[model samples]
Target chain A: MKRSFYLKIFLFVVLLFSSALADAAEVYYLGGPQGSSQEAAVNPSYSLKQRFQDLFSSLSSIRKDPEASGSISGHLSQTVVHNDIGGNREKSYLKPGVNYITDLNFSIQEKLHADYNFTGQWFLRKTDDPRVESRRDVRLKQVDLQVANERNLYQFGDFYGSFSQFVLGSSLEGFNMDINPTDDQHYQIVIARRNEADTVANSFQRNVFGFKADRYLFKGSDLFSDFRIGVQAASSQDDSASLPDNHTAKDLRNTVFGLDGEIVFKQGLSIQYEYAGSAYVEDEDASEKTTTYANAFRFQPSMRLGKANVRYLYYYAQPKFYTDAGSSMSDKIQNQVSLDYRFSDRVNVTVSENYYWDHLKGSSRTKRTFNDEKYMTWNLLPLASRRSFNLRPYVNYQVRNSDDPGNSAESTTLTGGFDISDRLNAHTNWGVGYECRSFIDRVTRSNSEIFHRIRFNWAQDMMLWARRLYYAITPNVDIRHRKGNDNKDVTVGAGFNVQYDLFQRVFLRMGNTLADTNSASPSGDYVNNRGFWEVDFLVDKERSAHFIIRGERNNYTAENGAQSYKEQRVIAKFEVNF
Target chain B: MRTKTIIAVLLTSMIVVGCRAVTGAVVDRRAVAQESLFSLAGTLIKDLFDNYQDFSMESFRAKVAVDFVSSRNDLVNNAASNIRAAKVLDIDFSLDQVLSDKDLLMVDLKWQKRTRPYDSSNVVLTEGFTQAVFKNVAGQWLLYQINKDNPF
Candidate 1:
């Protein structure tokens, strides 16, 4: 009864808020239109007939809903540079060996009712390499489909579970992820050195797929709920070729299964229990088949008083691994207790302490994994009374263990940040922290460090014929001090950006950034100083056509007392969205 | 230095015209006003029950310094005798929400009662009006739309 009461209150408040929003403003303000040169009135109720006509005239509306609709776009870039170092002049050309990048997406959403809806999207991309690629080439990007349903499946305590929409389920909607392009190459291989006639046709294919889905059952209740769940499983596989004798391939497969249930008591409190397990297989060693699994459970109790909301969550997960040696397990526990409190109208404070513990097996090892379990308390305070001026202060503290060693290692740090005037801004953050650790045979070392960063920035808008240009200057200083080592670095950077509309459908932009670091290592050169410049020209005509041309130059100082090296590149692309 | 100055001047001119700075303020003010009204209206409706007794449209009209004349549902002998009469004396109204440019006003009306409703126990009949209008002197919203049984 108490749980339901809370649910009613929650729904009532949401309803009130929505109505308030609607009656307060006839239409929502979401900024300017696409490629708009000026901000204009986007009133939805300006004219009901006109609004409907605009909607009907949209490209998406004309295409009609289908099982899927997507497109693929790719571009190519080339760079040629001449290097004159040590009196030796040489020219090197860099371009894509096989540049092909494409993205194909499709979605199908069948309307069930006015109140109940189901949607899904299928997303895929092909690329050659993600880390580094020529303007024209890409790598095995991604491919995945997702589906979701609302009020269409089973409902548990305030949760829903659907089995038919897991990851790659029939519902493919709302799939958004970054992807690189893909390039494919076909070749013929000789099965036998002497049997040229016995050649076999070969093709290289690389693809990555990621998806997320949940089957919610017995959901939307305040108390006592159960769910059957599955997901696309976060997994990836890659195969790439370099020079001869340099081939790398990887295959990772994962299948996830889970069940969850929740119980809401009469006191407006609830506890949720979830037991999920996954089987992950990777192509690493044939002799050793690796398997990893995890189970987690969380409990949350919440209360709302007027405009203030208070809630707490307690979560625990035990991850287990199986290897050829035997079965081993570890307990990873994260305990976070925080209160999100609002003070007045302009101040928000989030104070919380997080304790993470990763204990392997039953042994109490002094040194944990790469990131050891520690007790940390973080404080964030933000004050934004207006859009022009903002201030945020943060502090962090980590508890020290006896096994840790460092010189002058303190476990506390305090930092402050501030931003002023939309045009001019300044920020500074400083922290003092220490680390203590024990080495072999009970020998301990403690280290103390102080870090500080200060920067000031200024920017202003410039008017160009039917365009806007912006310029900014920033000066930065970084200071670090250890028990015995001290370092101080100062950098002055300037950047300029200009965007102009040459025609109704054409726009041009030029930007440049130059930063010069003036700190010399005990021995010598400031190798970190860099300069970059880029310009882009774009022509856009609604859904009809878009053309883009961009060129960039990067320059860096050499560390070996040699002349600086620079690389320049240019690219052009065209796209049509309908 | 001279070239930089010229470029700056040219850039500034271009931005001011391209962004339509002249019209930006007009659009922004309207949006801000609309948003403020929305938030305020939401708060008032959520707490309307608390002010039901004192919220009256007739009194609100009077408080706005507007004279009102009402025709009762029951009459006797075509005279003022046995006829329910309502006259707004003093009202204090605040526009809690206003949408459609300055056209529609979501008002929170507070006024005194001259003739009480027969069913005084029913809050809906006593203080049912939460929204009003100033579209015109006569065609203005005088009755609460919540009472759909009568459209007057």
Candidate 2:
């Protein structure tokens, strides 16, 4: 063994010397070096400097070439976690076990020929745990690629496509293209899977296709600063056969078309409108599948005048309207208006009202409900000195009325709150808030209730032993009273946190919260405590290490018995970026 | 002589009017450019809020960076719960400040929102100022980070 080791050492030395000799030859061929050719040949120190200079110059030359330049940046993280639970294991949110997780993410960008650029992103995650399925233990979360120029872009693998709110808006694993044919024309096309495939369960998948186009008019006109009109269409179908079982598949088929327009004037007025129509089939494979047709529209206008701003919105959707990729509420009509004004540099006010109704088709079994909401807020400095303190006060009220022949009902809610804060010094500050709320039910008096809540907080930053230390303390209380039984409930909570710079490169943070509640009902009574401490070490600009410990305990006293649980977890993580 | 004087006056008037017209056109062009940029930023921000309000995770994910980090730990779980628990009723915002770098845009704005929690009957009003950073990737601005508080 000794002989072999010595032989290896000798071979390594010989190889190293050979490489150095080759480098010296290259320097000689480059005219003996830069800045001092004679000295570089005679003096070893000067020759070393010249070699480094040459190396840097070549590297810089590579960087200067735009087409040859590329960047690779990424981060790697490894984490180990442990969790423990005691008392009523069924009530615990997480399993008791040890887990090891590794995450890797990176991005690459390169400039190609013909003024085109290429970008690629990749993400990978792995976790080891007995309860986790093997297929899920290791996963490729995302992989995306793109090639783009000034006016056009092409993407594949995984991309996010958004054409319009009511037509097509979602992320998909697909191919997408965006083309700007002229300064005033734009178009987009997308074809992709709407949902990720579940190979383990053999779940169904949705396939979607979308197209959109827009044209701009009066771009630079003083009367109409920006005017644009657009049209979008989308279609999706669920593959029932994709899932072997097919029991949970919806087998849905949907198609939507939309038209939208927007106009902005130089005089600080803007208006936007959109209309959409949809055809949907809930169960495509069923024997008597029925198709539904519905429509929806939205109109919004806003204006700015002097120190005031006003906005209005109107929205309506038919009962059967449905779009999986967009936000649409069916059988509804809504109208909203708001105004904001600035009285001075130190004071501002805003008021808004919203009215909405549901069950527009008036189905016999479904109750039609109307909701009205009003809100007002004020921001004020209150004090004569603008820097002394700040105050914000707000009020909100809402009413709901339901009509159902003989079972009509109405409810109202009012909430008022104020928040006050002040800075005592450069390193200390404090804030306090109070809120009162009341809910009244005309038909069901038993459901009426009132709530009062108060909160206080203080924060301080100090220099202790020439290091920075910061801490905050918060305490709050909430009380509730029910009208029918005169029952009362109360909850008190407190939280404290401290952060200190333990060393030049190390940071320490610890925080805990405690809450106790006493309610009329046994199920609502509980004591909860949670605490956590974390330490972070900055190894360098591109590397970091973190250690975190967390614990939680909850004690519940119910009518039947006491259900309690305690959990503790520890995690250690190291991350590096390149 | 009188005819020559009249001709000189007409020439001077034309020169002054032409200069004014050119100056006006230049100013208008600059204003239009500025307005377009602001409009673009405004639309992006509005779209983000709409997605948040709708609780569309896929659409929201597309607007943010892949390696997005937050000051609050467990950003993924917290974001999910926050979205599920709150129903946004109304939102108002003003984009008064925007700073541009090579591929990054930083926006500072004041905003107000009215929201109702799933378990609560009362609507809560909140107002604050926040700063958001967006990076241009393939001609699209993706949210990089937020300072102060995250609304979504």
| Best candidate according to TM-score | 2
In the range A1-578, model 2's lDDT, one tens digit per residue, is 53464345434433433333343334435532212212211111224454444434433332323223354555577877788887666554357888887766666655444345566767666877433224445677656677655445667865555666678655567887675433455567788997755666544688988876677777568799888887777888887877766376568899887878899999999998888888899989788999888889988899999999998888888888888665466787888888999999889998878788878773333788888878787889988764659888878787889877654659887777788889999999998877777778888887777777677889999999999999999888767777865556666778899999999888888887776666555354555576778887777643333444333333332222335566677877787655
* Model 1 segments more than 4 A misplaced: A1-257, A261-273, A277-308, A319-330, A363-388, A400-416, A419-448, A459-462, A470-475, A527-540, A562-564, B1-152
lDDT of 2 by residue, B53-121 (tens): 533222355588632322111232245345434445445575544444335565656676655343443
Candidate 2 docking class:
incorrect
In Å, residue A465's CA in model 1 sits off its true spot by: 4.3
What docking tier does model 1 reach?
Answer: incorrect
Show model 2 residue runs off by greater than 4 Å.
A1-68, A129-136, A196-203, A245-248, A362-365, A406-409, A543-561, B1-152
DockQ of 1: 0.02
Candidate 1 chain A, which ten residues in sequence have the lowest lDDT sum?
A: A180-189
**Tens digits of lDDT, candidate 1, A1-578:** 53464345435433433332332222113332222244332222224454344334443442443222211122222323222222101211223233333433333333222222223323234444221232334332212222112111211110011121111111111222211000010001001010011112121122223332223334444553433232222222223231123323333344443333445544444444444444556643235767555444444455544545555545454545211111112354545555566666556665555555555454355543221222222222233433444444443344423324532222432323332324133332222222222111112222343444444555556566746555555544433343333453333444455555555556666666554444323322232222334333333344344556566554545333333345454544454444
In model 2, the Cα lDDT at residue B126 comes to 73
TM-score of chain A of each: 0.53, 0.84
Reproduced native contacts, each prediction: 0.03, 0.00
